[model samples]
Target: MRNDFSNYFNNSSENKWYNSSYIGVSLSIPVFDGLQKRSKSRQAKLEYTRTGLILDNTKERFNVDFKNAINNYYNNKTNVERQNQNINLAEKVYVETALKYREGLASMSDLLQDEMGLSNAQASYLNALYNFKEAEINIMSLNGEIKYLINK
Candidate 1:
């Protein structure tokens, strides 16, 4: 019994401890996953492309709208200037006609006509001013300065 106990306890192979750690590298390539990974990759790529298209479309739309707003603003500004000139001309005509009527050189009908022309010119100027302001607001909106308009 003593020899058997000594053999069991004192054997080098049985009593020795071995380190189990090891360092190694291995690569595993997928053979088949029911095409789920492929489908996911395809979906991701499609979404990326769709997003790019949407971004481009948005940019085009914004550019067109901005151009239209600018055009409208300039047209309205010109109209306002033209209307102002018309108002000034009409005022001069009315004053001259009034003086001629007082001197008995212009008929009452001529004076009335001049007054009507001045009134129409003033009304047109007011309308043009309103349209110009509206166009200016649109321009400000397109330029993303709408906040300044609100503050004003």
Candidate 2:
């Protein structure tokens, strides 16, 4: 509803007071401007595609990392086994060298070298064992990634 009213300030012979009434109905229909709705729709589609791509890339990376971790775990485990075998072989050689040295068939230097080789084998075994443990830890980290993905 709307209203308008007025009174004449100067006197006139026509009339001193006036009254009027009016009633009207109006309708306003909105129209799109500048293709804003289409632009917004395209933007929403692009955003959805971008978000899906990001998730795909993240999942791909996780798969690669998980596979690599498992491979490294197995490889390090094999290395540890090889190193353990080396330790055993070195021990046997050192014992033989010691027996020869006692019976005068091997020199003290030979026995000492064999002992050092055994010690080095033990050190290598320890290093390989450490690598295996590290690989295990890396494999375990995949669990955390799984939890994150699940929550997300």
Candidate 3:
């Protein structure tokens, strides 16, 4: 609601006030915008769902990588232990072969074969150790950058 009032003057050497008054009233009722609101609501819901799916996918991927890192770490640890055992057994065999060769009960070829076996076992053990270290690094990396940094 609104109103206004004013005075008019007649230019006849005399000023006079005339009856001039205005009054107004207004009311607004809105109509729908061709389902624009509904469309925006649907878009918002779809965007929320898409965001949720993306979050779930990222979590699943991280889980898979973490599991793989742990598996590799355990497998490498086993390999290193096995290789160490092999080296120990190879050293014993080599020492026995050397003693036998000195007593003339074993030939030079037997001693040489035992020496080569010992060397191969040592190399395999080193390789296994290296693999174990790599797996450990992978696991630490998966845990977080902070852990890897701390270790470094």
TM-scores, each model vs. reference: 0.73, 0.75, 0.72
Top-TM-score candidate index: 2
With candidate 2 superimposed using the best TM-score fit, by how many Å does residue 50's alpha carbon deviate from the native?
0.8
The regions of model 1 sitting more than 4 angstroms off are 1-32, 148-152
Misplaced by over 4 Å in model 2 are: 1-30, 145-152
Task: For candidate 3, write residues 73-150 as lDDT tens digits.
Answer: 999999999999999999999999999999999999999999999999999999999999999888878778757588
Best candidate, lDDT: 1
Clashes of 3: 0
> What is the TM-score ranking, best to worst?
2, 1, 3
Clashing pairs in 2: none
Q: What value does the lDDT take at residue 150 in candidate 1?
A: 82
lDDT of each residue in 1-152, candidate 2, tens digit only: 12222333344456655688899999986675789888999999999999999999999999999999999999999999999999999999999999999999999999999999999999999999999999887886786754665688
**How far is 149's C-alpha from truth in model 3 (Å)?**
1.6
Q: Which ten residues in a row have the lowest lDDT in candidate 2?
A: 1-10
lDDT (Cα, 0-100) at 97 in candidate 2: 95
lDDT of 2 at 59: 96
The positional error of residue 14 in candidate 2, measured at the CA in angstroms, is 19
